[model samples]
Target: MCPVTVFEQDGCDLRVEWGLDGVHALGPHCAVLVVVDVLVFTTTVDVALGRGARVLPLPWRDERAAAMAEALGAVLTPPGLDESYGQPGWTLRPSSLTDLPAGTLLGIASPNGATLAAAAAETGTAVLAGCLRNASAVAAAASAIAEDRPVGVIAAGERWRPERTLRPSIEDYLGAGAIAAAVTGRSAPSSEATLAAVSYRAVRDRIPALLGGSISGRELIAAGVPEDVALATDVDVSTVVPVLDNGVFTS
Candidate 1:
């Protein structure tokens, strides 16, 4: 009865949904979108853009990845940090993008957020890469860009194991909530966005601890990327807002 995906067409002014399906259903409802992937992808984009680099987000890694980078004249993230291609100067990690020269176009690939970004463009809305680092700024920017257009905020959730179904990522939900709170302010938010905002406030005081112990956070720590988690949960530490334009994101 829900039409598989339904936009809760009622009160509030924003749509806060999750993953590709979220985009598919809610994208057209607004002309400005904020895509949040605090765990990594968008976080990397935020840092890169904060340093003045342009970013092109790719949905998934595949054969055309290298070709796309070359075509876009963007720097490719090395296949691995310790492998032969892991050049001393170039990287894909959010922490390492600071070394990239200003004015560079960085084409980044990720399994979730990046892909959702690409999909968001199809909605013909202005899309922005958002995270905890720039929540208030991104929300303010989105409010300005939206003007009269409705806004859609997509929390690009991580995959559930086994079937790899889209699972709500706590970090992403919190990130989305941060933006939602900023955007709504005294205004009422949709139920979804309200849920997100409440979730964020509940764990806001302990972001690092909450994320550090989350399933996704644990996986990143186990994989030796605790730094990424730290950088992402630093809350309001940045003002850079990565807005997607012409298939690229720039601050």
Candidate 2:
């Protein structure tokens, strides 16, 4: 029992941790891993899945992303709206996929959510995309996948630019908390997980305002994409649980 292993939350039926470190720490011990990137990533997945699109999560700036999309015959989502590429296709922004058609295969990239998700998948456990939009649904789906085994929820917090260090965001905390709260009664949760749920419950009704004023939310608003923040804070409005299958998320 290395002291570091204590972070794995061993013996807990539900555990919560933050960022890529969390995935690596708890992924192997849990039967199911839920990645929550509420400001965008997982929210985007929920929006796309709800619209019937299959989403392939790719690490941000992965050189193989284009090749992988080509190999899978999926549309490689643009990194973001570029004036040079007028009317660009889907992007990491949740609202960008609102018109995604049914049966579309989209490869989406992210530094946080997708990176955490890919790391979790390496542990060979079931991986799910969780967010505020689909919190309850993802919790139910993850519980079913775990079948009483441990379920690890990773809040995919943003990276500090340049150095790329983890910057925990309140939005993701609430998103993870929302899912953890949904599983409160049935699963024995770690203290970390329980705190998240408690925090979420304390501000459940003010989620929209809290998210809008959160650092990540403010960033999106400053970037003129406030709708993304609004969309991500919908709070259990979607029932679609984007489960990762064969490296792609399909409801």
Candidate 3:
């Protein structure tokens, strides 16, 4: 008989010893769960696709984003990089948030998304990347691979340097809840997640305020793209899931 184990935090089992260490420790047979909470990586993919701009992912900052874009005859812009982070090579573009050039590579730094993307680079399959903006689409893509297994949902938290009392944002949980409801056919595990999506469902106006507390939400606001987050939280906005292909973002 197979033994039973339980992880008390969410009433979940140990689930194969989570964390990047555990995932890499396994070496093989690790199903990757990518949760992109920054809202920039996933949302930009969705928005660009929606507006007919092709997108890619640059795992590092070494001219790759620009090099790939130039090779594809497109313009590149860095959304997550900041002056404090010592950005390189035209990291900020005035036209990025609105006018994304086709074949653009979005360089992201969310620890959660990066971790899952790395894991997906290993397995090639069973690596699901998702956000609340594309939650339903991600759920559908994941369901195709899930095929009777509990898929991982890595929550990409803040994009800043690690702090002592760091906390996960409501947006991540809200996105997780949406993905869970779509994939698990269950309600949100907490009021925050439930209200996040449900509130958007009930009133289309609260999304901006709800997202104002998110990691990217504040940055976006500071960058003068607050409306982007509001636009991102719109549920079922796209048909693309934006999976990680050998470290790049692809549908």
Candidate 4:
């Protein structure tokens, strides 16, 4: 379990940590859980939710996921970085999800963000998916749900090497920071949260360019999907907030 430092913010408590493991560690005290994956997953969720689609976040890629999707009458997304979801009403890229039919259901499998989201569902706290596009909305929704209860923001960082080790993702950090800052207002942020919030403020104006030049951004661009980067960096462009309940995300 990761060590959690509590912060008094907005006359309430708040906790921020990295990755799924951190979610497991601090989730119980977390009345509101915000999971951020700015590269694609959370961004896609934002877009899908904006279009009024119910998105089910599944952890890991396996044959079982297809069955779940079929049962939910939702389109299933493959767990690769490719731009396609191979379904009629779904796509992995956030920009593509904008045109989805309203009330559509989409089951998406992501290696990092979805995994943390799935795990966070078991904590009984309100679960929210956040990205650059909907950071303010997420913070508002989470704050409303949490009220005076503690809130936890989890940055679903990616692995660095072939082994499994959480490498701090700059985009996720900034996204989390933005949310944290928005949520806390003038509250005293913890050291880690402070760093993230400060980092986000520094590049608040250059979000699109910063994300485009990021490592994951470059990887996505190399994969022939630069539009995803643009969509993900459309800061505060969306007001729809996705809240997770019963294994699915809905606005």
Candidate 5:
């Protein structure tokens, strides 16, 4: 009834939505989007820039991704970090809002969420990453940006799979609510965002259980990353905004 449209597609509905094929066909067309890969998105961005690497985002066949980065003076790297670190060329890195301050521009190379960020960046609007960790801060920043300019929020999900069914990232969705709360100044989020927020909030005590259920969580524990998830789950530490520039991710 709000006249706003929300698109939902997955698994059994993949065929109806055209699944992976649909993303390639429809993803590029979005004017603005904020791909919120929350857990890894902001964390990876923070780590890459904190390490002092120039990050450039390359999205498979999306020519515009590289073109935009190049246009902004960013260097191109191998498809993924594996190939990039094996060679040389500024050593492309990853970044997010938590790594830089407001007003700094960055060219991102997200292995998984490049298309969403690319679409948003294409619109001449300020593109900022959002996460539950920085949800309120990001929303405030986005609201300020939107007051005088257009802004879009994109939730970066796992890899696009046509035939395979994937569940939406609960963390990212909760982060989105935080963003919406900041943007709209409403006591509650839109129905969809509210559900996401409630879901994640409800699982507060079950983080360990939830982690055990996740592929990445199991991998991290198995690899003995030592507090990797705990570090990622830190609710508040610094309110830095990571920005990408010339293939470098800086705060």
Candidate 6:
């Protein structure tokens, strides 16, 4: 057997890994894939879905994002955040989605979460968005969807700028841990998954503060969107589970 196969945690009912590489390693072996990008991507999805909006996850720099949104009749989110903070229009910021009307179709873009979700979708596995706001809900949904099959959780870590390499973000790990901890009773979790859950439980009370101080959260705060971090850290406030179906996330 290939060494890569060892990392799959094939015998476990629940698995966890970070980034797109995790998806490539574990997507094939799992029945459900949960993508966690707590800083923004998945958190935005939860908020939007809770308000009865559907989301189309798109790559951050994909030139086709607008065209694809037009083709799907969805509102394409702005690619840049030049003037999005505290504005009405949608970007990756979760606060802008507060008043999002029902039945809206939003094409949300991200470098981490959206990319991992799109990759997991290609594996033909069921993909669900998980984040701090809706961690418990997503965990239950993913567990039920798996139906005794393995479920893989992918933490969409931030990219180191300039080089754009993976920079594992604590917020994403904690979000993944939240979901994993929720489902621990239903399935046997891999060691990676267990560590995440344990870490989350250890800091469950300080999530908001930790998230605000995190590298990703600090960046957002410095960018004039502190509300984004605040909203993202609203643990268990949302019960929405945004599942990716046919290239869109609804309910």
Global CA lDDT of candidate 4, please? 0.81
Write down the lDDT of every candidate, Cα atoms only. Answer: 0.80, 0.85, 0.51, 0.81, 0.45, 0.87
Candidate 2 per-residue lDDT, tens place, 111-215, comes to 888777777788888999999989999999888888878988899988887798999999999999999998633557899999999999999999989999888
lDDT of 6 by residue, 73-105 (tens): 999876544346656677777889899999999
In lDDT terms, how accurate is model 1?
Answer: 0.80
Any runs in candidate 5 off by more than 4 Å, and if so which?
1-33, 49-54, 61-108, 148-152, 160-167, 181-184, 187-189, 204-209, 223-228, 243-251
lDDT of 1 by residue, 47-68 (tens): 8888888988876757787788
Q: Which model is ahead, 4 or 5, in terms of TM-score?
A: 4
Candidate 6: stretches off by over 4 Å: 1-4, 80-88, 184-187
Whole-structure CA lDDT of model 2: 0.85
- The per-residue C-alpha lDDT of model 2 at residue 205 equals 97
Q: For candidate 6, give the lDDT of residue 184.
A: 41
Tell me each candidate's TM-score.
Answer: 0.89, 0.94, 0.65, 0.89, 0.60, 0.94
Q: What is the Cα-based lDDT of residue 15 in candidate 3?
A: 23
Order of candidate numbers by lDDT, starting with the best? 6, 2, 4, 1, 3, 5
For model 2 the TM-score comes to 0.94
* Candidate whose TM-score is highest: 6
Best by lDDT: 6
Error of 3 at 232 (Å): 2.3
> Clash number for model 5?
21
TM-score of 1: 0.89
Model 5 residue 80 CA deviation (Å) reads 4.1
Q: On lDDT, who's better, 2 or 5?
A: 2
Candidate 4, 1-251: lDDT as tens digits: 33444422232356678897778766776688899999888999888887878898887766688888899898786564553633443566776676888988889887788889989988777899999889998998887887767778899988776685888888898899899878843354456777787789988999888888999889878877788899888889889798897899988
Q: Point out the higher-scoring one by TM-score: 2 or 4.
A: 2
What are the runs in model 2 whose C-alpha is more than 4 Å off?
1-4, 80-87, 184-187
